[model samples]
Target: MSADIPATYTAARPAATAEVSRQAWLVWLTSERRAARLTVETYGRDLAGFLGFLTRHLGAEPTLADLARLTPADFRGWLAEAAADNLSNATRAKKLSAVKSFLRYVERDHGIAVAAIGLVATPRARKPLPRALTVIDARAIATEIGEVSDVAALQARDTALFTLLYGCGLRISEALSLDRGQAPLPGSDAPLRVMGKGGKTRIVPVLPLAREMMARWVALHWQPAGDAPLFLGARGKRLDAAIAQKSLRTFRRQNGLPEHATPHALRHSFATHLLAQGADLRAIQDLLGHASLSTTQRYTEVDTAQLMAVWRRSHPRA
Candidate 1:
């Protein structure tokens, strides 16, 4: 929970000796692989854990040669050690993923065979359903956000941002990255073009309420340029996603909402509410910009569960 990143201590230089390959792998992961900083740190720890186990099992430090010569038994031993240490299935799976990724890189770049790594079975972990807010709670949260402050720009900005999320089913990143032209939510009833994950562009209809809120925010715009950022921070810079998330976190705390009331929940609520109203599954998938219909299918399960709950509450055959 500290402000300092845990991996800062583990950050090291690539040496010309035994650590040369590990450092090279780290460098490639960061530079070319486009891996996040946290990924580099956690993957580094997983590798370190693997090497530490190898040292105890083989009575020495593992060199690149030792890694290339590693057998399936060595990997099984490492997995067994992780299991004995009571690592959760999720943690174990992540560690295994890191190892596999590193070995895959070694195989491709260093010409080292990673057949043993490929044989390792990934640990199965349960996937939790995304927590979505109820329609009343989602609307209440949005209404409450606008009243949080007296500043017109801040109030309008928060209101517009939350409305875009619930009304349009946009990801936080997609919403935050919006320029005025890219996500023009004001003065238009047409579909707004949104660039989602993997550079896929999808056009989503703009709700009238969201458009009205956006009109309020744009009036206080500093530049009034078409291409300027739609949302601005305290200093008039493009709004940081954390600021919006923190605002929601504070709102949830103040209103006695559940812990799962996050910024992303608004998007989930958009989908769940639509599905509950008898929207087509495929249409919901397209509206939410989901590439796979299966991802959108989760809302069906949520709706069905809600239906069963309602039936139980209202049924006379108790």
Candidate 2:
């Protein structure tokens, strides 16, 4: 079993064949599938729960053959139990998805088809719309976030990071992944190349203000090297996403910014503001590096919601 799959999750031990296949499936997920560590762990726990249920339902530890013999009713019973436990629809859907993925893997890799499991329907969950900060708030965050840091370089780094996030609509992970050599400078017209989710690469234009802040931070970089991380922690290692998030949290509390004013909100603000200004939806999709235009379309919903709020306040109609 992968070390990432904790040995102590709420699970009954599977029979030998099931245990071996489960271990192999997890290895495939982490290695060949390139699934994120957290994703793997969550799926692992979901599968563990399913196995525990099977152990009780069958009156013995489940085996590969037992998984193939599972009926849709068995799956429904598990869903019913989860619903009784007060798991949200979204949580139940995710658990169901994990179970299906594992079953698919078993069929493909081990030639042990659990065709009955495929008959289960996934619970529908409403995806929450992206919450964007007002333009005034986004601009204020990019400018004032640095105040949370006393060290001049740290201040510049935080300011630069937030500026880039808003200006280029880069995810925090994508921004933190950049190297010193990829840093943009003032007057450089070349667009910044970002490696986004699923290892997809896309180039985004960097505004002059973002470039200016980045240049300032680069100037104060400690022992800078071409291959070194563009963003650094106090210990000179690559900055952790958690640390950057905490800095924003601290700044928000100090400045009374909305609780939703997060690093990601800056990215959401970028796309929403652009959409409101009549930028092409397709172009915004490319800039955001979204594989599907539907994903980028969420910004339109945010934009429409903002417009409705403005109209409601101004129309003065009873």
> Top model by TM-score, which number?
2
Q: What TM-score number comes out for model 2? A: 0.63
| lDDT tens digits, residue span 1-318, model 1 | 355645432232121223566678899989998999998998888987887888888787766567776788889888888889998778889998888887777667555665778677788885766678889999987666876677888998999899889888999898988887655555566788888888999989888888887778777774657688888999878999999998888888888888989889988999999988888999989888999998998888878777798899999994
Candidate 1 residue 46 Cα shift, in angstroms, is 21
Model 2 clash pairs are none
- Give a tens-digit lDDT track for model 2, residues 120-175: 88888868999999999999999999999889999999999999999999999999
Off by over 4 Å in 2: 1-123, 222-224
Please list the C-alpha lDDT of all candidates, in the order they appear.
0.81, 0.89
Candidate 2: worst 10 consecutive residues by lDDT?
8-17
